[model samples]
Target: MILPAPIPDRVDVVIFGGGVAGLWTRWRLEHAGYSTLLLESSSLGHGQTIASQGILHRGTKYAFGKDVSQASMELLMAQEVWSRAIKGVDGPDLRRVTVLSPTTVMWTSESFLSRFTGAVAAGVLKSDVKKLEGDARPAAFKSAPKAVNVWEIDEKVVDSSTLVRELARVVRGPMASLAPDAHTHWDLPGMLSWTDAAGRSHATHASAAVLCAGVGNESLITSLAGTTSVPGAAASHVSQRRPLHMVMMRGAPCDLFGHCIRELSDKPRLTVTSARDADSFVWYLGGSLAEDGVSRDESTQIDAAKLAVHECLPWVDVSRASWATLRVDRAEGRTATGKRPDTPIVSHIAAAGHTLAVWPTKLALAPAAAGRVFDLLETAGIRPTGVIDAGEPALSPAPLPWNEGGVRWR
Candidate 1:
């Protein structure tokens, strides 16, 4: 049975945010004997964690112009780390986690560009991609036209909700809720205090603090540092937003976990993953469709999804499918060109006191982010203190994004 935990007067570390990055960091630090407290403004996975398509990318999508860039190598390393964790060999044991698909398929139309992409992928990721013959293809593609080509790639898909639940089960911190507009203060010597909505002021002393709150990190850093930007003699903190409009379809004809490749594009034309509700199969779409959908209205986006699906999968009947759209922003360290960062971003602001701000560019890179945090703490000479057993109750877990009830269907 679970027990209540009271606020401790002190801790070795204080974490802000309950998402994957925050939870993973807590797990790692606590394992080393550090006392920790996690403060959450809302339910866990309420943001990008739940909004994601749950794809464990394998760098196939980032390959461009016959070369594998730093982004591609980072994804390959992430895959290795995640594979060990999922297999319970190293890191957290995720053996019980739900894996929606063990592998994903990549298919393309019969065209010059399409053939070129297949060749580049084959040369770059030779062992990772396998071409199938007539009878070896999946049933969904049996009805496809003669000109279509299909290849299987080594990428896995997981149930985001299930993954979050498993991570929460292993977290060691006493998770607590923070009021929407709670007032928080930080002092020079590592003292932190906050005023809850009930007008009760709680204070805690920590050796250090970390922020894994994604976009919310901006305001929190500004408020605590008393400046719009965190400026240090060594480094400065800045963030950028990349938004996506994702489409979801219920009652799909079949369960498909794959990507549709097009000629002359570095990204997939359509990326699809399937999950089951009580009675029907649901399809989640990402990739180029989601990135481009950001500029279109809801109705127009849904119509566009229908056309894309029909064009890509001629055998599927989408006329009876019900559609919905979800918009989410990806937070990352700002780049000179304002493009997405290839690797996770972790920044330390000595000028702002004992604080570290982190952004895991992709869900697959959570392990890498945690490793960076660990390195930062070690570099600062911060050691784990004894664990604290505060008697306060645990914070409630965040509901799945789909459960929030704001999904608009047309």
Candidate 2:
């Protein structure tokens, strides 16, 4: 469709969006030894990548209950995401080393645990499933057997932004160039910069392009060539169920000897996570506070969030707690029956013929997702993994069960 011709056509790839999906795509593509150029409408990590709750998501959390359909769609696959991040790339500067510590996550009911077991049988859940009869450990969740059942698993909190920066550095090389604090315009098989606060503009080109923009997929579709139309409504699903996680840090240990995964206050729609970050203990609270695009007022939202976070963990004095609010929009198509479209929706603009359109779970799938796109390019076809949804379903497929007296993690 009107790709820039100034740069040589030999360029292998052009990537849009500079967050986890985009940057990770850049890193993996460069390592695969293809000449690549990355462009973004705004600065990198301006999207959800930075807003992530910071869990390498073990996929174990998906073991909610018996609904295999929901569990399969929700399968953490994060294990793979984390695994690849640490594999193949090894250097002191690279985040090759990851720390996994013992943490306990509990579901208060056996009925819920049974649903989880059914999910495992359906391949939706991925973890060691056990049902217990008595109190669990971690000192935090330990209680009478009927009170709770905990699954002690390995979890790690890697530096998400640092991960992206490292990937960018690796892509650019030791003496390579970077255009941080820059804006880009995609003009099919290329990039054009008209102007910025810095003034003046420049142009560059590439062979193929990947649109890694998450919620901003709409703008990319309108501007870039080969991008198919992804209606604005679908993209905003994430913003519709916006949850604000306020992580209040105070009196957290000097060292993060391990991580904590307590069951924060309940929100049927979202997950609120509290754990020890770096040098401070954090009380993270979030859920479906905002529904269908009508989010809470910031001042009021902050107050409500503080109270919720403090309820579960009293150590965090909301008044004295230092805080940061992380917001993320859910993008799944829906969650009623837990059925997403069997395939992800990808569009190619025949006019520009260089850009591509993608949405939904595409963010969670990142690098491997990119690799699949590259393969499709070589074969002149598309292979979609799954569609998007807004937030977790009310009754997600139950994963394997874990509690007192049913079984153990031996």
Candidate 3:
């Protein structure tokens, strides 16, 4: 818990949420001379951001398709943006952020479609994939079957905890955590009134409002819809939640960051990223396994994970490894067909008095999402008129998902 800070009664913009998208937007706007105040009802990165695998995708994942997808293009641009920022060469300096892996591997099982995908991905991706053979392969893949092909894709992975910390460090305004009931009455045009945990009512008047609340965006959008005079404006601003039952294995045999590609599958069979968990290491599983595991119970998900590891990486031993499951929702902007969105979405509700709703469909797209916000603000003629002095941040970065407690490993 953070000590209370003096809340400013007014700002240029009032941002709702503390996830990566929210933090990034605050950083960008504040640096661009806009006065902003970020309000969070929970700890920073409490939802989708912290739960992410932290992969800065360089378009390799989308290369299996017939042509370059919108997601591929967005992520490709995002990788360069993130690389510059992390190297302190351009954008917001993030030199202190830790890059967990310089490149993640992609291995394919011996099959017609798998081999075809391997060839197509190598051709389509802007970033080159270096095929690792013989001794060049990591220990985890050394004993893999001869038919399995492993290529190192130039995708960077960062430590989510450090990323959040660095972003929060750069923001110029106060990031206060609001109470559960702090989804206060908005004074429509500019007023934002909410009560803190101390029962003190605070109000702020902003030139614009930004919603980056992830799943929490649903209610906020509904409220915005109620205020707007434009019919069907709410339809474009709605949120969707795609569930994922991710499997985690503690005491992983070896450090590995890669995706397992199978026959006729565009998505990875299992996307694993190793992270330091207390005194041990954890293999966090995602990809098709996670998407399909949504309907599975905890015990069944673990069983599926075990079987996946055995089939995907036969060399690795997880016989004694403890397993757990984390259920999370991938919050995104609602699409017409309810399918996954290919790019970051940024919508402006002009009728709702300078309100904008944003969803960075993937972690890699957060920068692009912020860029869109800038575009919207520019189009609306909103300028940085003054500065807001709200003191220091009033909330701390949330714990890593593995360390958040309540998981029962077996």
Best by TM-score: 3
Model 1 local distance difference test score: 0.78
The global C-alpha lDDT for each of the candidates, from Candidate 1 onward, is: 0.78, 0.43, 0.82
Candidate closest to the true structure, highest lDDT: 3
Model 2, residue 68: what's the lDDT? 31
Question: Which runs in model 1 stand beyond 4 Å of their true positions?
Answer: 1-4, 65-67, 134-136, 196-199, 227-237, 389-393
User: What is the lDDT, from 0 to 100, of the residue 90 in candidate 2?
Assistant: 36
TM-score of each: 0.92, 0.63, 0.94
Q: Could you tell me the lDDT of residue 31 within candidate 3?
A: 76
Q: Write the per-residue lDDT of candidate 2 for residues 282-333, one digit (tens) a residue.
A: 5434433323113554455556555544443334234655544434553332
Model 3: per-residue Cα lDDT over 178-294, one tens digit each:
785665656445788887666678888878888888888777777656766677566444667889999989998777888998764568999999897677689999999999999
Looking at model 2, report the run of 10 residues with the lowest lDDT sum.
Answer: 394-403
The 10-residue segment of model 3 with minimum total lDDT is 180-189
lDDT tens readout by residue for model 1, 1-410: 55546667888888888888887888788777888888877777667887777889888877753345877888889899888888989787777778988888888866667878777666766778898668767766878876677888889988887787777667556776667577777743477887654567788898888888877777677676664244542222467788998898988766788888877667788999888866777888888899999999989999889988987887767788889988888888777778888899888756566688888899988888988998888888888877765533365456554555777766
- List the candidate numbers ranked by TM-score, top first: 3, 1, 2
Candidate closer to the true structure by TM-score (higher is better), 1 or 3: 3
Please give the RMSD of candidate 2 to the true structure. 11.8
